[model samples]
Target: MAKLDFHIVNRIRAQVARLGDRAALRHQAAGQWLDISWREFGAQIHQLALALAGQGLKVQDKVAIFSNNMPRWTIADFATLYNRCVTVPIYPTNTPQQAAYILNDADVRVLFVGEQAQHDAALALADDCPQLERIVVMDESVVLADHPLVCHYRDFIDTYAPQADVAVLARRLDEIRMDDLLTLIYTSGTTGTPKGVMLDYANVASQIESHDQKLALDEGDTSLCFLPLSHVFERAWTFYVLHRGGINCYLSDTNQLKTALPAVKPNVMAAVPRVYEKIYSAVHDKVSRAPLHRKVMFTWAVNMGARMALARQECRPPSWLLQKSYNLADKLVLSKLRDLLGGNIKFMPCGGAKLDESIGRFFHAIGINVKLGYGMTETTATVSCWDDQCFNPDSIGMPMPGAEVKIGENNEILVRGPMVMRGYYNMPEETAKNFTADGFLKTGDAGHFDEHGNLFITDRIKELMKTSGGKYIAPQVIEGAIGKDHFIEQIAVIADTRKFVSALIVPCFETLEAHARELNIKYQDRLELIKHTQIIELIEKRVVELQKDLARFEQVKKFTLLPKAFSMDQGELTPTQKLRRKVIQDRYHQQIEEMYEESHKRSPRPH
Candidate 1:
């Protein structure tokens, strides 16, 4: 049976239809209010979908969408899926070249862009990409000029669009089969060119079911989205919000999340570790500058949080003494933290990157539910997610229903389920290689399942390095360890055919600033600040602290902290913020060599 589900969207239409003036979408445009209803939303999507079809767009064709999260973005995406065409999403921050590659790889037939920068990128490739026949500008207010390839989104909809007739559209929807390929997302491969991971409609449908079962979704649930909808993790969550009948209030941008959160007043969120890290930093910064009484109280509460986090990480119940201390602290101290989150926040599901275990536990201690999850694009973005009822701070929790997770011979996590991707698109050999003959998707991550079937990700296979001296080490291990230091914001370890281990770091600028203030030192920029003898010594001391538990050969011999932070736009980081070690090494080969040479010079001579 080919069953089509209205899922979350259908329920919203039924309830809100009774209220004649209720708004389904609220937009603040140029400081003016814009309200849309279920009727208008449906009409807009139906018109857009029909327009696309009228323009010779066929089922299974790739339609490229490049934009930030917006109301139109979701409407356009759902319409594309409804028409049985695939949607390839490009991140807003992607450079022209990166955008071109994804467009070309997918053989995109029509492009819908949100801004001028994205339009310029698409225009740059118009001559080269034969498959790209049309360009629809989402921000139609921009002048299209005389570009033959460009088309205004609203104009196209009105001109050639068929009048939306819902009954007719439902029949067209029947053409979409469950197993048909629906989308292709590129995994930001660390070593080589990023590969496109193909996912089918069934994969998405099953994932929706899994989330609906696991998450405590209620009729009142809503999401304030800031994470790039282009990402598999975020996109999947967005779809689930629609499926669960939850309202999605798209944030303008990640930078504006703090201001936007209060306005949207979301009940639930799924975000990456960096988002939580920023929140933690913001709180810590405030505490550092608070009045004496408030500072003392904040510090005391934070101490209790730290201890509670440690207990959760170690899977130990808090001692009665500690529980009493934390409970009393929460009422007077931690309650204020909730107020900052608009006092309505419920679940903040963290994924995309491994969160520092302590960070997750700290949030839990403060009565904030920050559950963690584990997945790669290969696993359709979620293998396991923390179950609140049976929460374990150290584990990624049990696999979602119908998803099979097993440890392979090499201790690599193997997954098999409807959520597993069809394989890398147009790369048969590569696809064949990624799976075992028995057909499990071999995730290139190193990890194991616990006795209770909770999953843990230990390291990445590709991140494991072998030195020229024949010593092997997991760079992820060293990087993860270094990242735990309060002074380091980001860390990337290097040991690929090199004599020993080294690291590239981006320091905590706020911490550095405070340290400089205490020492009566002044620096104009991060570059100058990093070169200070005091700062270098502090970081070196931290490296030594992390090395205490590591094998001598795996220890960091020397390090360098960059002036600026790593960024996706700069090509230093993937969309997911994973360090591109090869790119970093090549960009600073001489600096790394100098650090290593300086390391030996600083060592005492052997008698």
Candidate 2:
């Protein structure tokens, strides 16, 4: 294959000339949607590049973006790239200490923050991180502190951009190399301190080529940038969208995704499995309460849709009778479901966690293509994704065109590709340990390929639990099954070296409260509500039903319900919403112990 142009700055320049006045980015503010044209986007990147250069930021200097999803995030990202500087992103939900660790570790000279919260966090870190020289606030309405380092974004650009030499910035862009560090994305640190994954322009460039070959994105397509740009999944997709000349509508507040979906009417987007799972649960919960006739109609429509979807997966045409049924089904029920997701979805890429197979199949059955893929920050987002013709809900789809994947010792998924990261920044020993003697990156995930070449992930090798009876269990598989219940919000399985499996569960309070009301159960607060025998019984019944397919030894024998959800702020969840198993086990140690003690008292040698 021929070498691809990996220079991002040149791509933006070419896009500016080609797209001219077309909308390149969009954002919602003050109850209205706003558009930033390609020309405007290019100009902003140029100005910010010049401003950073004027601030004495030299080549390869690290810059940090501590913001939620917004158009300016991408502007700052490209600006840093144009100046040949490495960009480091900090999750907006990260606490002050977490954000400070990234800043100090990356030696970030300039920090771009989103709102007052991030601004305040950065202000608090001023005394701790001495290398942080400048703070540029993205939201103009945020009140600044009296510190000399802080400046509003408008003034920052207006003051420095004009004085800086544009020719010098352009010269640096022209000198771009494939090995230039594109970004340093710190891991969520589920187990320990976050490590900076070093990704370069070559990694990103290969992703662009692979996605272009697999996905059906077009120049006129629009994408909803729903996931945080701090995550590699969204960041890579955003770059690809720009490369394809697609419009990227940024949603700063993720809580507004339900409202924004219809408002934006995006053609393509990328999101984690949690988003799809919630939507799937909500739709089903609503349908379960509908009138009998409506319920019958929904069931029939879904069955018909499923038949059509299966036919397509087999690369066969549906029969005339089935086609007619599906058309009517689409009009009556499926289309309404699709409308909730903007109704114009060409495809929505899902990753970051394993999507429940039922939820994956349901979305595809309703004509909303949810392409389940797999990857990590180290792989620059996508190792494999479902193409148009590949539609197996049980698999993570085929490997990328230029990537090599195989099962190594212990069934670990090993990968060697141009898209793989350089290594962990400043962690030479850790990097050396991750790669094998011949250079395949040990992914730590256990999976296997089917006869058709589809990859099916089994479990995380490090997370597998071994019972005292010598039974090995995959926690994610059990968690994925039980977590699909509408009454459950989050779960963490605890069974490593134990005689039986147990879990810490957080209920979907909204659904639980509604059920409580129906049952005439009274409670003063969430804590009281969870302790009610009727509430516990309700959850226990659901758990038993959901885990019926699992082996007797692998089922969750006991569970404790918490009033609150696992959260990033609490260190119980990663920024991507993955449970930090160790943190949860440590925090709920007593509750877990009590469950096992009670089980032992009931049956001394249980299981």
Candidate 3:
């Protein structure tokens, strides 16, 4: 039996009692920072829960939140839990059809909407979903006139406050068992419909406990959260941050990161690999445009800093000359780079996708500790995370405390822990298929334990590509190897049924255009620029250099330059910003076919 104290609602109540007037959350409203104290946070949750109870939300009733990353999103999440109702979070960027499917599948009766877009999306979905009975708008400015089921957030919460039955809600909250369903997180499937992953209170509690054993946060620390709360990684991380009594600063708009980093200067934050990739590109772009002498000096300083960083990571003392060189490097070049992320950063935990090793090393070279971890929504967001004393660019660190990991048949990473989710919601067949007879969850990721007991993810089992020559190619490895080029923003390797590997490359227009200017290359737009002879030569040179580490068969033989980068809007990227390989290949079938046409003509032994 799980203790009631380990439950999330109880943990929030404990924090309210301990912290009192201490600021718990910070968010922007009308362009001004507003702080919600621990007591006030509790009060809001209590009132919101009372209102939910007024709406006849019984225990285990499904409620949904369709919102961006905001203070209200966090508050509403707890409010739903306080009423003992399961919360379903739909990503803010999810299409109306996606949101509707989740609502219908989860049987969500009451939905808390965020901004105008989310409100409109919900309204559009309400007619299709018979189970959806009411819509509560989080933004006060939303204008929904004479909608029978529509209610302002304030009106809804305040309506039942006067007639609230606190005792009943309290009893329900107390009756919440650890095995009770906490959330229904729908993971987008590779094929067919998305399935809802049912995570119980015990699963979440175990995640918190396991992560806490690996790392502890300071009470005074502040964390900036920009990732969507609908994603398990950010949601679990936020819960952990709150448990530690740290202040959470929510970024409603991801585009505000550049300005918010300086203003908030958060001590810790977690982000996906794309964030680091963009920063790396920007840094290199500026260096490329610098004077020859400055460029040479910067390169020397960075090399010296990387040497020192490598030495420190290995627990070896740097040579006296290297130490002096690093001191000068840190003073002259690295310090300014650190300032870009608001030098107060203690560490930034990066995951949700494979982070390029070069980018990780670059940040570490300049004093930013990017803790790369590996996990999924099923594992409650973190299985293993790199620590202070141990950092490896290749490994995702040892198994986190309380979590058991083993490489099973076909090198599949098998995880068995309290942190693992119970099963897919309402899909017992899928639930049975995903888990082994003995209960270990098949991660679908092919990886192995290194000599030092660190875990190295080789490739995704389902995503591996097999060519006609009977060679298996890991496209992610190929993509990661070449995607770090300053001019290449994104790359997707395509070779599944083909004779040789090729790629669909999206250039980093910012760097490429700057180089074009230096070379006096003329172009009307990106399409024209990519077609230029010099531009093609430049990309070819970069691709050749980047693929030097790859095997002859694994190397990209030919690639077509894409005029535009892959984006979520086009269904080329997932909500978490990972590339949808199949989608990209389908969308650009012509270009991919063109690359293979030449190969078909050259393969003499083939039909």
Candidate 4:
């Protein structure tokens, strides 16, 4: 292995040296937030690395972390890297069968699990996974099986750290190479079986350097980590935060974000677009129901904030009158909007799915920088992102510095840079097929760059749907538009081989239920409520308004309101919350067929 000085382990080690007493990690337990100082972070990783070494793990050995976002998860990640072993992260929400697939595929020797569910799942798979040797449960309260392989995290570290020779870990760290495989992140598998994307230290190092140039993060920054660490987006960002000596505040449960945001008051964070969309929808929903005078004031304030935001985007100062109006707007309305997101957001990196332009603009108008970007797991999280100034909400911004992006055949976005993954692990044929003869990685996404270098994604090449009438439709565009409504929670568009676009929608029950009370629409349960004629009309009205800009063929002509949201448990969504389209289509085949069948029964309508 060729040696490298600027690897992740060494970077964190340097941070420990420079910022010993400062908090490197933070997490909530019981009712209080706790900090892990840089010194403590380094020490825990050292102990864990020695412990892993004592377990007979060698260089390139695969170690899996099956856990939620917590301090231990990060520690285990860095510790695995410190041993020069490949770290594989399993989504904490994965079923036992799913978890077993990754463990057996990677030949994972040691599995670190987080709560009782993960621990139980690991134990169930141990006998089937012949190569698996140990299970370290991070949560102490998890009841262990009567198996010799099972051990508490505390016991594992304490027993093995002293027995292991420190020199072995040192030598392994010294042997660290830029080309050494750092991680094997499995794709979300929206289309098919998940493939392990092989990313090396060079991929990560390149990302750090690129982000340093495009974004700003200093030692004083605090980033709230709520996205699943199993996903490359959050994992890479977390590493970058630590690399910059910034504190990473881990929120194990996203539901507690309501309280955690105010408590932690993090200045920087990264999240999928869904989080921002939900916040935007909720805020607007409340404002729409406010008193008439309050609504008028909000409209005026938003207009002033928008003017200021536009001036900033154009690299010009707002006029004196506009500046005063913006100052008043900031104090009365915009500041309150910012408070919803902790009131100290320097910028939030948004990815994973297309963000609605309206939602993006709203965040900018309210002085919250939601930097929408585009990327995938194979690219190590970010391919392109908006800079601090001069951004178009409709575009994904320019490519990262040192990264080359070109539109290939059929408008596929081709990338060639250090951030590109080495290949799909153990799948040479798959890797070979994905890369061009010229070495550029086929991104499988269709997009074009604007004159100003901003990349705008049109659609996933594989996901585009063609109707019976031969009109092509982008499902995400329709879903993104309608999904932004306050009453809509989740949506899946169905147009392939159909007469016209249709959708399966899951309403925001809380907001819908409140609206039902206002309308005096009484129901015993969600199913009955969604079936109400008035309720259906209410949703249909919003859908019609949202789709006004879409082509007639692209518009959702028919829809069914579902009582329940698409969930991971039902295999309807991936761990990262991306829709498993085939699964959704297959599971709701009857509902989908009815929408088409009902259309055939209707009176002939204009195209």
Winning candidate number (lDDT): 4
Against the reference, the lDDT scores of all candidates come to 0.76, 0.89, 0.87, 0.90
TM-score of each: 0.90, 0.97, 0.96, 0.98
Candidate 2 accuracy as TM-score? 0.97
Report the C-alpha displacement of residue 262, candidate 3, in angstroms.
Answer: 0.6
Candidate 4 per-residue lDDT over residues 178-223, each given as its tens digit: 8999999998788877899999999999888888888878886999
lDDT of 1 by residue, 229-344 (tens): 88888888877765555666776557777777677667888888877776776676667667999999887897897677667656779999999998888889887787677667
Candidates ranked, most accurate by TM-score first: 4, 2, 3, 1
* lDDT for 528 (candidate 3): 99
The segments of candidate 2 whose C-alpha lies over 4 angstroms from its true place after superposition are 1-4, 599-607
Clashing pairs in 1: 8-243, 8-245
Candidate 1 local accuracy as lDDT?
Answer: 0.76
Residue 427 in candidate 3, Cα distance off native in Å = 1.0
Regions more than 4 Å wrong, model 3: 1-3, 319-322, 599-607
| Predicted candidate 2 versus true structure: per-residue lDDT over 64-164, tens digit per residue | 99999888899999999999999999999998999999999999999999999999999988788899999999998999999999999999998888878
